[model samples]
Target: MTRPAAPSQFDDPWQAQVFALTVALSDAGHFPWTDWAQAFGATLKRHGANRALDGGADYFNAWLETLESLLEQRGLAGQAEARTIRAAWEQAYLSTPHGQPVKLPA
Candidate 1:
């Protein structure tokens, strides 16, 4: 199966780093989309539109940093280990087959 095109910022190296971090945290059970969306919305509220746009990358980076800390605190993964796992997960998700359900390891 084909993967969708990576989002615009995702094409950038630094942006891809943050994106990978976020995806990794999600996979590691740090926080689900509902929790993330709420946090993101709260961030937007505190920052307002202009700053949100201008500093969005920094915001995402901060979010990722926080996620890593949370994961470590919960004993889910250490920071370096999480980075390795995240990289593997990013490659697998973006390259694997589609249109058929695949069993994921727990």
Candidate 2:
């Protein structure tokens, strides 16, 4: 499958995380885009519009942060696990293909 472009430093990390989570989950048949979009919109409202990212990279980063927080809160992962996940994401981000939809490692 085609992968999306890598996010730039100017991009929000949380958004990128959430976007990646959404993509990964959807790819796994766990949730749909509409549901993810609705939840994302609500998250933005609750978290504040300023937290709502503008660019692809920024959005992905925001999403990633959200995912880590949620995972921690849900007791699915610990700080170490989150750190590992973040590191892996960083590596993937650096190596990801530009202008295509790439799958995040599960």
- For candidate 2, write residues 10-103 as lDDT tens digits: 3455555556665886688655667656656666566566554454554554455555555565575677876887788787887888875655
Please report the candidate that would top lDDT against the real structure.
1
Global lDDT for candidate 1?
A: 0.65
- Worst 10-residue stretch by lDDT in candidate 2? 7-16
Model 2 residue 31 distance off true place after TM-score fit, in angstroms: 2.6
Clashes of each: 0, 27
**Candidate 1: tens digits of C-alpha lDDT, residues 1-106:** 4445653454358676767877877778767878767666665566564554444466665566655666676687799897787787777677678865443345
Give the least accurate 10-residue stretch of model 1, judged by summed lDDT: 2-11
Provide the overall lDDT of each model, using Cα atoms, as 2-decimal numbers: 0.65, 0.61
- What TM-score, to 2 decimals, does candidate 1 have? 0.42
Q: For model 2, what is the C-alpha lDDT against the true structure?
A: 0.61
Model 1 stretches with alpha carbons more than 4 Å out: 1-7, 49-106
